[model samples]
Target: MTDRLTIRRPDDWHLHLRDGEMLKAVLPETTRHFARAIIMPNLVPPVVTAADAADYRDRIMWAKPKNSDFKPLMTLYLTEDTEVRDVRAAAEIGLIHALKLYPAGATTNSQSGVRDFKKVTRVLETMAQIGLPLCVHGEVTNPEVDIFDREAAFIERVLDPIRREIPELRVVMEHITTKDGVDYVAGGGDTIAGTITVHHLVINRNHILAGGIRPHYYCLPVAKREEHRIALRAAATSGDPTFFLGTDSAPHTDAAKLQPCGCAGCFTAPNGLSILAQVFEEDGALDRLEGFVSEYGPRFYRLPLNDGTVTLEKGPPVEYPAQIETGDGPVTVFDPGMPLYWRVVD
Candidate 1:
């Protein structure tokens, strides 16, 4: 059996480093493992302008740990009223790496998301012209639709129409959780790709509802059925360039996560790398781990690979912290519900 492995430091194609105290606390958890991350734009006010992205990036830089060579790639939240000129300028100056599309009321702090797709036609056109990628939340907010079916429905009702209209647009189906999502991306052209999260690959809806209501296991586009989880694992470990790692390592304080109508996100940054190593190993795709986590994302985004490398060693089970304390509060860490024998060796 393989006891040790080393690969290029990976990049998170989708991540949520909440602003302020939460940002300061969780930033290190990711920077410690990932070389760079595509920072989410769904803050309370949302990053809507070039200036907003610039300011957010500056704050992230300020909060970064000393001597850490981490880079936070910024993104703008797309709104119905977004202007084309602003997006073009943001891309031209490299102030933002992509535009995040969150259908209004789709998820946490996403009230400012786009409600009318037609209103953003001009902005989408500009993005395609400028070679900017669209990182989508991938779930429709229609209350009538069953929560488990939203992702598959969104592809039929929203994503497909948009892609057909703007065939050249680069779209990332973020945190996709259904076989339908997998099939869509697999059948689509090169302009489309899918980001599979560690939590989704590890847990299914059963992990959230079976035995008890495990809120920590809950998240938007909530984990699907076991068969779907298997499909996600297959796609992620398939070595297909179209699928890659995007932990979607969203963080929420324990209080926020346990309260009435708790927030939707999983705090996985602390153990993300270790958890992924286990998943790939279980899938018998250990040899392709590098392509899934490190190679595919950069190639999809047209960015250069990282210079640094990180090694994972097979050793005794790692005792990960149950929760990480931040100035804001205590944030619960993701529990993979199994012993992780492979750990990143410092």
Candidate 2:
């Protein structure tokens, strides 16, 4: 049996590092293994302006662990009022890597998301011209659409139209959770790609509903059925350039998660790589792990691949902390519900 594996350090194509105390607590979990992450812009006010993105980037840099080479690839939260000139300027200065689209009331702090897509036409056209990718939440907020069907519905009613209008615009369907999402990206050309989260790969809806509603397993774009999980694993391990890792490792205090209407996100940053190693090994696709995690994401973003290497050594099952303390409160780490024998040694 293979005992050791080393590959180029990975980059998280999608991530959420909230501001202040929470940022400090969670930043290290990602930086320890990932060289860079495309930071989410779903803050309370949201990072809408280039100036807002710059300020948030600075805060992330300050909150990042000392001497950590963790680069935060910032993104702007797209709203109806987003301006074309600002989008171009943000890309010109490298202050923003992509524009995030959150359908109004879609997820946490997304009340300010785009409501009138028509208002952002100039912005989208400009993005197409400049080659700035759009990272989308990929869900519809209509009350009539079943929560489980929102993703597929959004693709049919929303994404397809947008792509038809702007064929050159690159789009990264962030944290895709369904077989519909997988097939959509697989059939698309080079202008589109999808990111699959580690939690979704391991847990299905049953993990949350079957056992009396485990709150930590609850997240937006909630996990789908076992068939979807199987499809996600197939895409992740298939060495297809269209799919990559983007652990939407959103951290909410246990108090927030356990509330009447809890926040939506899973804290998987701490043990994401470990869990991924386990997933790939079980599928007998160990050789493709590096390509999924390290290679495909950078390729989609058109950024250079990371130079550093991380080694995972297989041995006895490793233990991960149940919760990480922050100034706000304790955030629960994702529990894979099984032993994790593959661990990052460096």
Candidate 1, residue 308: how far the Cα is off, in Å: 0.9
- Tell me the number of clashing residue pairs for each predicted model: 0, 0
The lDDT for every candidate, in the order shown, is: 0.94, 0.94
Residues 74-130 of candidate 1: C-alpha lDDT, one tens digit per residue = 999999988889999989987889999999999999999988899999999889998
Candidate 1 error regions (>4 Å) = none
Sliding window of 10 residues with minimal summed lDDT for model 1: 88-97
lDDT of 1 at 143: 96
lDDT of 2 at 233: 94
Deviating ranges (above 4 Å) for candidate 2:
none
